[model samples]
Target: MKLISWNVNGLRAVVKKDFVKTFEELDADIFSIQETKLQEGQIDLDLSGYHQYFFYAKRKGYSGTAVFTKEEPLNVHQGLGIDEFDDEGRTLTLEFKDFYLINSYTPNSQQKLKRLDYRMRYDDALREYMQKLSVDKPVILCGDLNVAHEEIDIKNDKTNHKNPGFSDEERAKFTELLNSGFIDTFRTLHPDDVKYSWWSYRFNARKNNAGWRIDYFVLSDNGKKMLKAADIHTDIYGSDHCPIELDLDI
Candidate 1:
């Protein structure tokens, strides 16, 4: 099975920039998107062969997520069971017969670190939610996690240490998640690969290749061995972020 995840930045904007064509070319069995930045009736996307599921933020033109799958899931749930976190429409859980696929748009800590405390609380809550799901079945967690997990994840780690997405506290929380039994599928497949998925729109960063590997597809240990291939679609363009894909033998 092939699965792909991307933070399109904004679905409405990207669709006009060839998003539908790109989506078709990727040909994934399941494709998940974060940061849709749209609400109901805002845009009409025709995904002929896929079943679409969306979780929209209560706030218009803000954080949102969607999943388009060739096969319909047995069940789908929005949010992580906390009303506070759910209000942002940051998470969507799809239960298949064999595992749970979670697509998330993790909250950014903000440029000034203003949202740091809330992000920390979100980290704890997300961990608990993933763990609880793991008890029932293996989980495939994917999307823009919004944190550069380690020095290896960003080009200029030293300079970015205090930055919101690259801060030590945020990275450590990602570490904590990995230590809890989830494996970053891309890293596992390409241990030495140094490519990035998200880049800053500022200072011509994308052109210069100044980027951070913040997006991910993390699989539970039980699902790790099923991974066939993992890749980042660096050449695909539309958003500041590119797509990350995974293929599992199962």
Candidate 2:
């Protein structure tokens, strides 16, 4: 199964930017999107042969997530049941026969790490949530996790050490999550690859290829056994974030 994960930045905005053609060309069995930034009824996307599920934030034109699967899932869950986090509609889980697919848009710590504490709480909750779900079946978690993870994951790690996505606290939480029985699919498969998924729209970041590898496809150990290939589609454009993909033998 070929899975695609992308933080479109804004679904409506990307739609007008050849997102349809890109989606068609990728042709993934499951396509997961984060930061959709739109409320229900805002955009009508006709993706033939796919079952679409969306979790919209109460705040209009803000954080949100979505999944479009060619095969219908056995069950669908909208949020993590935590009021603090649920209100933003940051997560969506689709339960298939073999695994649970989680689409997420992790909260940014913000400039100066003002929101780092809250971001830590969010990370802890999500990690526990994934662990709980893994008790029944392994989870395939994918989205813009909002952290660069390591020096190798960011272009300017030295200068951005304390920045939102590159902060030590955020990176530590990501490590804790991985230690809790999950694998960062792309990093594991391509250890030496200097690739990135998200870039700032400022200072010609994309043009210069100065970016952060914030998007991910994380899999539980059992699910990791099925992982075949992992890729970063840096050539694709529409959002500040490019699309990341994972292939599973299942």
Candidate 3:
């Protein structure tokens, strides 16, 4: 099965700019989106033959996630079940017969690390939640994790250090998560590939190929055998983030 994950930045906005065409072209078995940035009834998308699931933030025009799957899942879940994090509508989980797929939009620490404390707390809670789910079944976690995990993952690592998405704390959290039993599929599959999934809108970042590989498909360690192909679709455009894909033999 081919699964795709993208942080569309905003569903309403992207849909106006070739989102439907892009969606149809990708033709993934499961397509997961983050940062929908809308509330209920904001947009009525017509995606035939796919089951649509949307999770909205309590606040309008804010964080949200959506999932489109050709196959109907056995069950679906939203959030990590923590009041603080659940309010943001950051995660959408679908349970299949053999595994769990979680699409997430991890919180950014924000300018000057203003929200760093909250982000740390959120990461810890999310880690615990993912670990709990992994105990039940292998989990496929993907989305804009908001951290440039390694120096090779970001273009200006030296200058971006300690910034919102490149901070030491955030990187450590991601490392800990992997150590706890998740595999960074793209990096594992293409260790030397300097590809990025996200680029800044300003400073001609995309034009110059200055970007960060913040979006990812992280699989439960035991599910490594299921990973067939992983990629960062840097050529695609709509949002600042490009879609990442993970193909599974299962």
Tens-digit per-residue lDDT, 1-250, candidate 3: 9999999999999999999999999999999999999998889998989999999999898889999999999999988888788899998999998799998999999999999998999889888888999998899998889999999999999999899999999999999999999989999999999999899999999999999989989999878889899988888999999999999998
lDDT of 3: 0.93
| RMSD to native, candidate 1 | 0.8
Q: What lDDT is obtained when candidate 2 is compared to the true structure?
A: 0.94
Worst 10 residues of 1 by lDDT: 218-227
Instruction: Kindly list the per-residue Cα lDDT of model 2 for residues 1-250, writing each as its tens digit.
Output: 9999999999999999999999999999999999999998998999999999999999999999999999999999988999889999999999999999999899999988999998999999999999999999889999999999989999999999888998889999999999999999999999999999988999999999999999999999978779999999999999999999999998
For candidate 1, the per-residue lDDT at 20 reads 93
lDDT of 3 at 220: 94
Q: Which ranges of candidate 2 are over 4 A from the true structure?
A: none
- TM per candidate: 0.98, 0.99, 0.99
User: Residue 160 of model 3: what lDDT?
Assistant: 96
Give Cα distance to truth, residue 180, candidate 2, Å.
0.6
CA RMSD of all predictions:
0.8, 0.6, 0.7
Tens digit of lDDT per residue, candidate 1, span 163-228? 999988998999999999999988988888899999999999999989999999999998776889
Residue pairs with clashing backbones, model 1? none
Off by over 4 Å in 1: none
Residue 138's C-alpha lDDT in candidate 3? 90
Q: What local lDDT score does residue 116 receive in model 1, on the 0 to 100 scale?
A: 94
